[model samples]
Target: MSRLTERLHRMLHADDRLDREMAAEWEEAPAGKPASLPPEEVNPDTPAEQPDWWISVPFRQGRGLRRLLVVLSVLLCVGIITVLVITAQYLPHFGQAGNPANNEVSRRYIENGMEETGAVNIVAGMILDYRAFDTLGESNVLFTAVCAVMLLLRVSADKRRSAAYQLELETDDRMYEPKNDLILRSIARLLIPCILLLGMYIILNGHLSPGGGFSGGAVMGAGLILMLNAYGFRRMERFFTIRLFRAVTVCALSFYALSKAYSFFTGANHLPSVITPGTPGMIFSAGLIPYLNISVGLVVCCTIYSLYTLFRKGDL
Candidate 1:
């Protein structure tokens, strides 16, 4: 019994000594040279398995498809260019006596346009009376362009939460339009009223003179741009805002459309129309030409200003 107890004590001491030696060796091991684990404890690393066959197949197929699409697109573009070139070859030369545009229509417009449309400007008489819808379409195109710009650039009011964002807005505004420029403000103060008056004159006299909705509207838009550059957005914002822009544009377009519809309905039914060609060479002449010019000018001014503000500060 004594010998058996002595053997058990020896075994316990040996196990303790073995653990201490192993711990010491592990601690002494150099950082670059880690002590190897026992063969049974060492995990045999497996190489990273290739992605699943299904996944790899799709990636390869997608690459091939992308190349094919690119080739097809190039081929399509070339085909379209070739067709256009061929078509251009058959077109009539400019200023040819036999040109289709040199027709009875031009003669009619030149001869009786003033008496029929009450517009001293023959071109205005023809366009406003004969092709007013086209003019409306052009105005709507400008409106659409501004709307698209707003969608892309305008910032949502709800998201302006942080000081950092407000600072960024101020920085951008300052960069584009200086807050305090005495020279610019002074020049604008003198020129702005004149420019505005000139624009109004052009629009009102569209039917009486060479100027019309498109030209007059462009002039007004330019004036607005000058005002924006001279005065800061805050001053402009007191009267012109996103809501005002929307309301004015919508109302003008609506009025123009309704006016045209009424004319079309009356003409188609051979009914007496309320709108008639008033006195030629007068401010109120050309039944709807002057009014249409006003509508177009409003649309143009709002669109131009909105585009500038939205782009500058992502707000309007």
Candidate 2:
């Protein structure tokens, strides 16, 4: 019995020693940071040392691109600046001293449309009949911008959290939610509808007056933004689905393109339209011109609203 006990004791002691040696080895291993470091020692790895001059130098070198580009850019800028300066200098003389392009376009739209299409508004005539293609291009641009903005929005919180743990990334700030204010919200609610209605009116009247589709659409979009701030994202989502906006955009662009192609192919470009560009000064009618302006206004308003929603909400 005594001999058996002695053997057992030796086995236990050996196991204990092995455990202790392993623990010591682990503690002494050359790994991560020590408990302390000398204050005088500096960390060599820092963002400040990694100079970004390589990236910056490329931009500097780009300044010496083909002379043609420089000349063209300068000429373009000068032309625009010259127009703005001259406009600022003599806007009062706009009607008295007319530009050939402006006069020709205006005269063709107002005079010819009434004579041919019987449209009352010159601006409407220009957009709907003469420049539908341009409106379509502009609408596509807005749609593209909306998509890009949405794509850049931050990922979901769960995704962000997963990334932080897996890749050691810091948390990104979430979009802000405004504090509740009953009074402000009420005011917004009251004002938003009026603003939207006004925009619609502007769009509708574009053929008859100074305002056009772009202006009207932009105004309505602003109203939508205001409503989002005042009410909430959910409400906006419920009311204005992206699908609806996409449908409207596609339809408008399609109609514009197809109509323009038809007009061009059929050589109806100068042919008289069904609608009379009513007497030059009348507010009652403009031919297809007013309709085109309304379409553009709708497209612009939808685009602006869609963009605002994408940035603010981040979810598709």
* TM-score of every prediction relative to native: 0.67, 0.56
Model 2, residue 313: C-alpha shift (Å): 2.9
Taken over the whole model, the C-alpha lDDT of each candidate is 0.79, 0.66
Angstrom error of the Cα, residue 264, model 1: value is 1.6
How many angstroms is residue 216 displaced in model 2 relative to the true structure, after the best TM-score fit?
Answer: 0.4
Writing each residue's lDDT as its tens digit, candidate 1 over 1-316 gives 9976775564435435545666777888977777764333222362122211222232333444667998999999999999999999999999999988888997888898998889999888877778888888999999999989987887655446544456665667467656669999999999999998998899888888888777777788788889888887778888888889989999999999999999989988999999989988877888988898889888987888788778777888
Tell me the spans in candidate 1 whose CA falls farther than 4 Å from its real position: 1-102, 170-177
TM-score of 1: 0.67
Give per-residue CA lDDT, model 2, range 9-54, as digits (tens).
Answer: 6543543554465567667766763433223223456534223222
> How does model 1 fare in lDDT?
0.79
- After aligning candidate 1 to the native by TM-score, how far in Å is the CA of 17 from where it should be? 55
